[model samples]
Target: MTSFQQLLTDLGNKSLSVLDRNIPKSAYVPLDLSVTNAALKEVDVSSASKLGEYINRHIAMNEGKVAYGGYLEKRGIYNRSDYFNQQNPETERNIHLGLDLWIAAETPIYAPLEGEVHSFQNNTNFGDYGPTIILKHIINTVEFYTLYGHLSLASIENLQIGDVFRKGEQIATLGDASINGDYAPHLHFQIIKDIQQYSGDYPGVASQKDVVFYQENCPDPNLLLRL
Candidate 1:
Protein backbone atom coordinates (compact mmCIF):
# COMPACT_ATOMS: atom_id res chain seq x y z
CA MET A 1 0.00 0.00 0.00
CA THR A 2 3.03 2.31 0.31
CA SER A 3 4.28 4.38 -2.62
CA PHE A 4 7.75 3.78 -4.05
CA GLN A 5 8.86 7.39 -3.67
CA GLN A 6 7.90 7.44 -0.01
CA LEU A 7 9.81 4.19 0.49
CA LEU A 8 12.96 5.81 -0.83
CA THR A 9 12.46 8.73 1.50
CA ASP A 10 12.04 6.47 4.52
CA LEU A 11 15.23 4.61 3.67
CA GLY A 12 17.08 7.91 3.29
CA ASN A 13 15.80 9.28 6.56
CA LYS A 14 16.56 6.09 8.46
CA SER A 15 20.01 5.68 9.93
CA LEU A 16 21.24 2.58 8.13
CA SER A 17 24.72 1.14 7.81
CA VAL A 18 26.10 -0.37 4.66
CA LEU A 19 26.73 -4.12 5.01
CA ASP A 20 30.46 -3.91 4.46
CA ARG A 21 30.86 -0.43 5.91
CA ASN A 22 31.55 -0.28 9.64
CA ILE A 23 31.58 -4.07 9.95
CA PRO A 24 34.69 -5.67 11.35
CA LYS A 25 37.29 -6.44 8.71
CA SER A 26 36.92 -10.16 9.40
CA ALA A 27 33.34 -10.16 8.17
CA TYR A 28 34.38 -9.14 4.66
CA VAL A 29 36.83 -11.97 4.22
CA PRO A 30 35.77 -15.32 2.76
CA LEU A 31 34.77 -17.64 5.57
CA ASP A 32 33.64 -21.03 4.33
CA LEU A 33 32.68 -20.58 0.65
CA SER A 34 35.36 -21.69 -1.79
CA VAL A 35 36.96 -18.59 -3.32
CA THR A 36 39.31 -17.74 -6.16
CA ASN A 37 41.40 -14.66 -6.74
CA ALA A 38 40.51 -14.00 -10.36
CA ALA A 39 40.69 -10.25 -10.71
CA LEU A 40 40.74 -10.48 -14.51
CA LYS A 41 37.59 -12.59 -14.66
CA GLU A 42 34.79 -10.87 -16.53
CA VAL A 43 31.66 -10.18 -14.52
CA ASP A 44 29.51 -11.19 -17.46
CA VAL A 45 29.80 -14.32 -19.57
CA SER A 46 29.44 -13.14 -23.19
CA SER A 47 32.19 -15.12 -24.90
CA ALA A 48 31.95 -18.73 -26.04
CA SER A 49 35.14 -19.47 -24.15
CA LYS A 50 33.69 -18.07 -20.95
CA LEU A 51 30.33 -19.73 -21.30
CA GLY A 52 31.85 -23.09 -22.23
CA GLU A 53 34.10 -23.03 -19.22
CA TYR A 54 31.15 -22.29 -16.99
CA ILE A 55 29.15 -25.24 -18.27
CA ASN A 56 32.04 -27.68 -18.10
CA ARG A 57 32.67 -26.73 -14.50
CA HIS A 58 29.04 -27.24 -13.60
CA ILE A 59 28.84 -30.66 -15.26
CA ALA A 60 32.01 -31.82 -13.55
CA MET A 61 30.85 -30.86 -10.08
CA ASN A 62 27.38 -32.29 -10.48
CA GLU A 63 28.95 -35.59 -11.53
CA GLY A 64 31.03 -35.83 -8.31
CA LYS A 65 34.30 -35.24 -10.12
CA VAL A 66 36.38 -32.97 -7.91
CA ALA A 67 38.06 -30.13 -9.74
CA TYR A 68 39.13 -26.53 -9.25
CA GLY A 69 35.73 -25.70 -10.73
CA GLY A 70 34.07 -26.80 -7.50
CA TYR A 71 35.75 -23.90 -5.79
CA LEU A 72 34.02 -21.52 -8.15
CA GLU A 73 30.78 -23.44 -7.78
CA LYS A 74 31.19 -23.20 -4.02
CA ARG A 75 31.51 -19.46 -4.27
CA GLY A 76 29.00 -19.45 -7.16
CA ILE A 77 29.52 -20.34 -10.79
CA TYR A 78 28.46 -17.23 -12.64
CA ASN A 79 25.87 -17.14 -15.45
CA ARG A 80 25.41 -20.89 -15.57
CA SER A 81 22.22 -22.70 -16.58
CA ASP A 82 19.85 -23.34 -13.67
CA TYR A 83 18.51 -26.62 -14.96
CA PHE A 84 19.45 -30.16 -13.97
CA ASN A 85 17.93 -33.55 -14.85
CA GLN A 86 20.57 -36.30 -14.93
CA GLN A 87 21.78 -36.40 -11.37
CA ASN A 88 21.60 -39.37 -8.99
CA PRO A 89 18.99 -37.53 -6.99
CA GLU A 90 16.45 -35.81 -9.18
CA THR A 91 16.78 -32.04 -9.11
CA GLU A 92 14.63 -29.16 -10.23
CA ARG A 93 15.57 -25.98 -12.07
CA ASN A 94 15.78 -22.82 -9.99
CA ILE A 95 18.43 -20.23 -10.71
CA HIS A 96 19.83 -18.07 -8.01
CA LEU A 97 18.31 -14.57 -7.82
CA GLY A 98 20.73 -12.53 -5.73
CA LEU A 99 24.39 -11.82 -5.33
CA ASP A 100 25.82 -14.19 -2.73
CA LEU A 101 28.31 -12.61 -0.32
CA TRP A 102 30.56 -15.58 0.35
CA ILE A 103 32.49 -15.64 3.59
CA ALA A 104 33.48 -17.81 6.55
CA ALA A 105 31.14 -19.49 8.98
CA GLU A 106 29.48 -17.96 12.05
CA THR A 107 29.77 -14.33 10.99
CA PRO A 108 27.36 -12.10 12.83
CA ILE A 109 24.63 -10.64 10.61
CA TYR A 110 22.83 -7.50 11.66
CA ALA A 111 19.66 -5.85 10.49
CA PRO A 112 20.31 -3.03 8.01
CA LEU A 113 17.55 -0.98 9.63
CA GLU A 114 14.60 -1.13 11.96
CA GLY A 115 11.82 -3.23 10.51
CA GLU A 116 9.30 -5.94 11.31
CA VAL A 117 9.97 -9.54 10.57
CA HIS A 118 7.83 -10.48 7.61
CA SER A 119 8.60 -14.17 7.19
CA PHE A 120 11.12 -16.92 7.93
CA GLN A 121 11.66 -20.46 6.72
CA ASN A 122 14.17 -23.24 7.01
CA ASN A 123 14.77 -24.12 3.38
CA THR A 124 17.17 -26.97 3.97
CA ASN A 125 18.32 -28.90 0.93
CA PHE A 126 21.26 -29.49 -1.34
CA GLY A 127 21.50 -26.60 -3.82
CA ASP A 128 18.89 -24.76 -1.81
CA TYR A 129 19.02 -21.70 0.39
CA GLY A 130 18.98 -22.71 4.04
CA PRO A 131 17.46 -20.86 6.96
CA THR A 132 16.11 -17.88 5.09
CA ILE A 133 14.46 -14.80 6.55
CA ILE A 134 12.54 -12.01 4.89
CA LEU A 135 12.02 -8.65 6.55
CA LYS A 136 9.38 -6.11 5.56
CA HIS A 137 10.56 -2.55 5.87
CA ILE A 138 8.88 0.75 5.19
CA ILE A 139 11.18 3.48 4.08
CA ASN A 140 10.05 6.88 2.88
CA THR A 141 6.52 5.48 2.72
CA VAL A 142 7.53 2.60 0.43
CA GLU A 143 7.30 -1.05 1.39
CA PHE A 144 10.05 -3.38 0.32
CA TYR A 145 11.43 -6.79 1.25
CA THR A 146 14.93 -7.80 2.37
CA LEU A 147 15.73 -11.49 2.29
CA TYR A 148 18.64 -13.09 4.17
CA GLY A 149 19.59 -16.61 3.20
CA HIS A 150 22.20 -19.16 4.34
CA LEU A 151 21.58 -18.07 7.88
CA SER A 152 22.32 -19.90 11.09
CA LEU A 153 19.48 -22.07 12.33
CA ALA A 154 19.21 -20.14 15.58
CA SER A 155 18.29 -16.97 13.75
CA ILE A 156 14.78 -18.04 12.90
CA GLU A 157 13.93 -20.07 15.99
CA ASN A 158 12.46 -17.20 17.98
CA LEU A 159 11.36 -14.83 15.25
CA GLN A 160 7.76 -14.32 14.13
CA ILE A 161 6.18 -12.35 11.35
CA GLY A 162 5.47 -8.73 12.38
CA ASP A 163 7.85 -8.83 15.33
CA VAL A 164 9.57 -5.45 15.49
CA PHE A 165 13.34 -5.32 15.50
CA ARG A 166 15.72 -2.36 15.71
CA LYS A 167 18.32 -1.31 13.20
CA GLY A 168 21.68 -3.06 13.58
CA GLU A 169 20.07 -5.61 15.78
CA GLN A 170 21.56 -9.07 15.82
CA ILE A 171 18.96 -10.82 13.73
CA ALA A 172 20.82 -13.88 12.51
CA THR A 173 24.15 -15.65 12.24
CA LEU A 174 25.71 -17.06 9.06
CA GLY A 175 25.21 -20.79 8.55
CA ASP A 176 28.20 -22.98 7.87
CA ALA A 177 28.75 -25.68 5.23
CA SER A 178 27.11 -28.57 7.02
CA ILE A 179 23.72 -26.86 6.98
CA ASN A 180 24.02 -24.00 4.53
CA GLY A 181 23.51 -26.16 1.47
CA ASP A 182 27.05 -27.59 1.65
CA TYR A 183 28.74 -24.37 0.54
CA ALA A 184 30.78 -21.86 2.48
CA PRO A 185 28.62 -19.77 4.77
CA HIS A 186 27.64 -16.31 3.59
CA LEU A 187 24.67 -14.00 3.56
CA HIS A 188 22.50 -14.14 0.43
CA PHE A 189 20.80 -10.77 0.63
CA GLN A 190 18.15 -9.63 -1.83
CA ILE A 191 15.66 -6.79 -2.24
CA ILE A 192 12.23 -7.81 -3.47
CA LYS A 193 9.21 -5.72 -4.41
CA ASP A 194 6.73 -8.55 -4.89
CA ILE A 195 7.12 -12.05 -3.48
CA GLN A 196 4.87 -13.38 -6.28
CA GLN A 197 3.09 -15.71 -3.85
CA TYR A 198 6.41 -17.32 -2.93
CA SER A 199 7.40 -17.31 0.72
CA GLY A 200 10.16 -18.70 2.94
CA ASP A 201 12.68 -18.93 0.06
CA TYR A 202 12.98 -17.17 -3.28
CA PRO A 203 15.45 -17.74 -6.10
CA GLY A 204 18.90 -16.34 -5.34
CA VAL A 205 20.16 -16.83 -8.90
CA ALA A 206 18.41 -16.83 -12.28
CA SER A 207 19.34 -17.77 -15.85
CA GLN A 208 19.78 -15.29 -18.72
CA LYS A 209 16.27 -16.22 -19.83
CA ASP A 210 14.94 -15.03 -16.48
CA VAL A 211 16.81 -11.75 -16.30
CA VAL A 212 13.81 -9.53 -16.90
CA PHE A 213 11.56 -11.38 -14.47
CA TYR A 214 14.15 -11.24 -11.71
CA GLN A 215 15.18 -7.66 -12.45
CA GLU A 216 11.71 -6.34 -11.74
CA ASN A 217 10.69 -8.66 -8.92
CA CYS A 218 13.99 -8.44 -7.11
CA PRO A 219 15.92 -5.18 -7.05
CA ASP A 220 19.49 -4.94 -5.86
CA PRO A 221 19.84 -5.04 -2.10
CA ASN A 222 22.61 -2.51 -2.57
CA LEU A 223 19.90 0.11 -2.94
CA LEU A 224 19.49 -0.21 0.79
CA LEU A 225 22.83 -1.67 1.89
CA ARG A 226 24.90 0.30 -0.65
CA LEU A 227 27.57 -2.39 -0.30
Candidate 2:
Protein backbone atom coordinates (compact mmCIF):
# COMPACT_ATOMS: atom_id res chain seq x y z
CA MET A 1 0.00 0.00 0.00
CA THR A 2 1.03 3.60 -0.55
CA SER A 3 2.18 5.71 2.37
CA PHE A 4 -1.05 7.73 2.37
CA GLN A 5 -3.21 4.65 2.45
CA GLN A 6 -1.11 3.33 5.32
CA LEU A 7 -1.52 6.61 7.17
CA LEU A 8 -5.29 6.35 6.93
CA THR A 9 -5.13 2.82 8.23
CA ASP A 10 -2.96 3.94 11.11
CA LEU A 11 -5.50 6.61 12.01
CA GLY A 12 -8.32 4.13 11.95
CA ASN A 13 -11.01 4.39 14.64
CA LYS A 14 -9.84 7.91 15.42
CA SER A 15 -12.15 9.52 12.87
CA LEU A 16 -15.87 10.20 12.95
CA SER A 17 -18.73 9.75 10.51
CA VAL A 18 -20.02 13.00 9.05
CA LEU A 19 -23.58 11.74 9.28
CA ASP A 20 -25.64 11.00 12.33
CA ARG A 21 -24.87 7.83 14.27
CA ASN A 22 -28.54 6.95 14.38
CA ILE A 23 -28.38 6.35 10.62
CA PRO A 24 -27.73 2.68 10.03
CA LYS A 25 -24.90 1.50 7.82
CA SER A 26 -27.45 -0.29 5.63
CA ALA A 27 -28.97 3.09 4.84
CA TYR A 28 -25.86 4.26 3.01
CA VAL A 29 -25.73 3.18 -0.62
CA PRO A 30 -22.41 2.99 -2.47
CA LEU A 31 -22.83 4.87 -5.76
CA ASP A 32 -20.07 4.22 -8.25
CA LEU A 33 -19.69 3.13 -11.86
CA SER A 34 -19.94 -0.47 -10.61
CA VAL A 35 -23.49 -0.07 -9.42
CA THR A 36 -25.54 -2.07 -11.93
CA ASN A 37 -28.66 -2.61 -9.91
CA ALA A 38 -30.15 0.81 -10.65
CA ALA A 39 -31.54 2.46 -13.80
CA LEU A 40 -28.54 4.81 -13.90
CA LYS A 41 -27.43 3.38 -17.21
CA GLU A 42 -30.62 4.55 -18.92
CA VAL A 43 -30.87 7.99 -17.30
CA ASP A 44 -29.26 11.11 -18.77
CA VAL A 45 -27.12 12.05 -15.79
CA SER A 46 -25.48 14.82 -17.75
CA SER A 47 -28.44 16.96 -16.93
CA ALA A 48 -28.52 18.07 -13.32
CA SER A 49 -32.30 17.81 -13.09
CA LYS A 50 -32.31 14.33 -14.54
CA LEU A 51 -29.51 13.30 -12.23
CA GLY A 52 -31.48 14.59 -9.28
CA GLU A 53 -34.46 12.53 -10.28
CA TYR A 54 -32.28 9.48 -10.72
CA ILE A 55 -30.77 9.92 -7.26
CA ASN A 56 -34.20 10.37 -5.71
CA ARG A 57 -35.46 7.19 -7.29
CA HIS A 58 -32.41 5.26 -6.19
CA ILE A 59 -32.82 6.43 -2.62
CA ALA A 60 -36.50 5.54 -2.58
CA MET A 61 -36.00 2.12 -4.11
CA ASN A 62 -33.25 1.20 -1.70
CA GLU A 63 -35.23 2.49 1.28
CA GLY A 64 -32.21 4.62 2.09
CA LYS A 65 -31.87 8.26 2.98
CA VAL A 66 -28.53 9.04 1.34
CA ALA A 67 -26.55 8.01 -1.75
CA TYR A 68 -22.78 8.12 -1.29
CA GLY A 69 -20.20 8.74 -4.01
CA GLY A 70 -16.70 7.35 -3.60
CA TYR A 71 -13.47 9.23 -4.07
CA LEU A 72 -11.72 9.29 -7.48
CA GLU A 73 -14.86 8.02 -9.24
CA LYS A 74 -15.22 9.39 -12.75
CA ARG A 75 -18.76 10.69 -12.59
CA GLY A 76 -20.22 11.25 -16.04
CA ILE A 77 -22.93 13.42 -14.47
CA TYR A 78 -20.64 16.47 -14.74
CA ASN A 79 -20.83 16.72 -18.49
CA ARG A 80 -22.57 20.07 -18.49
CA SER A 81 -21.00 22.70 -20.72
CA ASP A 82 -20.92 25.12 -17.85
CA TYR A 83 -18.90 22.70 -15.73
CA PHE A 84 -16.89 20.64 -18.21
CA ASN A 85 -15.39 21.11 -21.65
CA GLN A 86 -17.93 21.78 -24.40
CA GLN A 87 -15.68 21.14 -27.41
CA ASN A 88 -12.96 18.81 -26.12
CA PRO A 89 -14.44 16.05 -24.02
CA GLU A 90 -10.94 14.78 -23.24
CA THR A 91 -10.28 17.78 -20.97
CA GLU A 92 -13.41 17.33 -18.91
CA ARG A 93 -13.01 17.40 -15.14
CA ASN A 94 -14.80 14.16 -14.27
CA ILE A 95 -12.74 12.80 -11.38
CA HIS A 96 -14.44 13.62 -8.11
CA LEU A 97 -12.03 14.76 -5.36
CA GLY A 98 -14.42 14.30 -2.47
CA LEU A 99 -17.27 12.21 -1.10
CA ASP A 100 -20.79 13.20 -2.12
CA LEU A 101 -23.75 12.62 0.13
CA TRP A 102 -26.85 12.78 -2.05
CA ILE A 103 -29.89 13.67 -0.04
CA ALA A 104 -32.89 16.01 0.12
CA ALA A 105 -32.72 19.78 0.43
CA GLU A 106 -32.46 21.33 3.89
CA THR A 107 -30.80 18.30 5.42
CA PRO A 108 -28.54 19.23 8.33
CA ILE A 109 -24.73 18.86 8.02
CA TYR A 110 -22.53 18.39 11.03
CA ALA A 111 -18.81 18.69 11.66
CA PRO A 112 -17.05 15.36 11.92
CA LEU A 113 -14.46 16.87 14.24
CA GLU A 114 -13.68 19.97 16.26
CA GLY A 115 -12.63 22.81 14.03
CA GLU A 116 -12.90 26.54 13.43
CA VAL A 117 -14.38 28.18 10.37
CA HIS A 118 -11.51 29.20 8.14
CA SER A 119 -13.41 30.96 5.38
CA PHE A 120 -16.68 30.97 3.38
CA GLN A 121 -18.14 32.42 0.19
CA ASN A 122 -20.91 32.11 -2.36
CA ASN A 123 -19.39 30.93 -5.63
CA THR A 124 -22.07 31.94 -8.16
CA ASN A 125 -20.69 30.26 -11.24
CA PHE A 126 -23.09 28.22 -13.38
CA GLY A 127 -21.96 24.81 -12.07
CA ASP A 128 -20.00 25.78 -8.96
CA TYR A 129 -20.45 25.29 -5.28
CA GLY A 130 -22.96 28.10 -4.61
CA PRO A 131 -22.36 28.46 -0.89
CA THR A 132 -19.14 26.98 0.48
CA ILE A 133 -17.47 26.79 3.86
CA ILE A 134 -14.04 25.62 4.95
CA LEU A 135 -12.91 24.62 8.41
CA LYS A 136 -9.41 24.25 9.87
CA HIS A 137 -8.64 21.53 12.33
CA ILE A 138 -5.59 20.26 14.20
CA ILE A 139 -5.64 16.61 15.15
CA ASN A 140 -2.69 15.13 17.00
CA THR A 141 -0.62 18.12 15.92
CA VAL A 142 -1.37 17.42 12.26
CA GLU A 143 -3.18 20.36 10.73
CA PHE A 144 -5.80 19.87 8.05
CA TYR A 145 -8.91 21.41 6.54
CA THR A 146 -12.39 20.18 5.67
CA LEU A 147 -14.61 21.75 3.03
CA TYR A 148 -18.39 21.81 2.83
CA GLY A 149 -19.82 22.73 -0.55
CA HIS A 150 -23.16 23.14 -2.33
CA LEU A 151 -24.95 24.48 0.71
CA SER A 152 -27.90 26.78 1.22
CA LEU A 153 -27.18 30.51 1.00
CA ALA A 154 -28.65 31.03 4.44
CA SER A 155 -26.04 28.65 5.79
CA ILE A 156 -23.37 31.32 5.52
CA GLU A 157 -25.47 34.37 6.29
CA ASN A 158 -24.13 35.09 9.75
CA LEU A 159 -20.99 32.97 9.65
CA GLN A 160 -17.65 34.57 10.37
CA ILE A 161 -14.05 33.45 10.34
CA GLY A 162 -12.58 31.80 13.44
CA ASP A 163 -15.95 30.55 14.64
CA VAL A 164 -15.37 27.36 16.59
CA PHE A 165 -17.50 24.26 16.10
CA ARG A 166 -17.59 21.11 18.16
CA LYS A 167 -17.59 17.65 16.69
CA GLY A 168 -21.05 16.69 15.42
CA GLU A 169 -22.24 20.32 15.64
CA GLN A 170 -24.71 21.35 12.94
CA ILE A 171 -22.68 23.47 10.54
CA ALA A 172 -24.83 23.89 7.44
CA THR A 173 -27.80 22.57 5.47
CA LEU A 174 -28.05 20.99 2.02
CA GLY A 175 -29.23 23.21 -0.86
CA ASP A 176 -31.47 22.71 -3.89
CA ALA A 177 -30.57 22.84 -7.56
CA SER A 178 -31.63 26.47 -7.98
CA ILE A 179 -29.02 27.97 -5.62
CA ASN A 180 -26.56 25.11 -5.43
CA GLY A 181 -24.97 25.72 -8.80
CA ASP A 182 -28.03 24.21 -10.48
CA TYR A 183 -27.37 20.64 -9.39
CA ALA A 184 -29.12 18.08 -7.24
CA PRO A 185 -29.37 18.56 -3.50
CA HIS A 186 -26.26 17.15 -1.81
CA LEU A 187 -23.21 17.87 0.34
CA HIS A 188 -19.70 17.83 -1.12
CA PHE A 189 -17.34 16.97 1.73
CA GLN A 190 -13.61 17.07 1.15
CA ILE A 191 -10.39 16.79 3.16
CA ILE A 192 -7.39 18.86 2.22
CA LYS A 193 -3.83 18.66 3.54
CA ASP A 194 -2.36 21.74 1.81
CA ILE A 195 -4.99 24.18 0.57
CA GLN A 196 -2.22 26.25 -1.08
CA GLN A 197 -3.49 29.84 -1.39
CA TYR A 198 -7.20 29.06 -1.57
CA SER A 199 -9.48 30.38 1.13
CA GLY A 200 -13.17 29.70 0.77
CA ASP A 201 -13.08 27.40 -2.24
CA TYR A 202 -10.97 24.53 -3.54
CA PRO A 203 -11.19 22.32 -6.63
CA GLY A 204 -13.55 19.41 -5.98
CA VAL A 205 -12.72 17.82 -9.35
CA ALA A 206 -9.42 17.29 -11.15
CA SER A 207 -8.25 16.29 -14.61
CA GLN A 208 -6.47 13.08 -15.51
CA LYS A 209 -3.06 14.77 -15.56
CA ASP A 210 -3.38 15.98 -11.96
CA VAL A 211 -5.35 13.06 -10.54
CA VAL A 212 -2.31 11.54 -8.86
CA PHE A 213 -1.44 14.76 -7.04
CA TYR A 214 -5.02 15.19 -5.86
CA GLN A 215 -5.30 11.58 -4.80
CA GLU A 216 -2.49 12.23 -2.33
CA ASN A 217 -3.43 15.80 -1.36
CA CYS A 218 -7.04 14.82 -0.85
CA PRO A 219 -7.01 11.39 0.74
CA ASP A 220 -10.08 9.19 0.81
CA PRO A 221 -12.72 10.94 2.92
CA ASN A 222 -13.96 7.50 3.98
CA LEU A 223 -10.96 7.59 6.30
CA LEU A 224 -13.01 9.94 8.39
CA LEU A 225 -16.53 9.03 7.33
CA ARG A 226 -15.95 5.32 7.97
CA LEU A 227 -19.19 4.64 6.07
Best by TM-score: 2
Query: How does residue 42 of candidate 2 score in lDDT?
Result: 87
Give me the displacement of residue 10 in model 2, in angstroms. 5.2
Q: Report the error of model 1 at residue 131, Å.
A: 0.5
Task: Report the lDDT tens digits of candidate 2 across residue range 1-227.
Answer: 65555555565476566667678878998766333435677877657788888878878888998899758887666665456544454566778899999988898899888899999999887878999999998866777899999999999999999999998899999889899988888899998988899989999988777888888899988887777
Give the least accurate 10-residue stretch of model 2, judged by summed lDDT.
31-40
* Pairs that collide, model 2: none
Model 1, span 112-213: residue lDDT tens: 877888889988756467798888887656677778888888888888888887888878888875676655455687778877777787767554455567
Q: After TM-score superposition, what is the CA distance of residue 188 in candidate 1 from its true location, in Å?
A: 0.3
Off by over 4 Å in 1: 1-15, 18-21, 24-96
lDDT of each: 0.58, 0.82
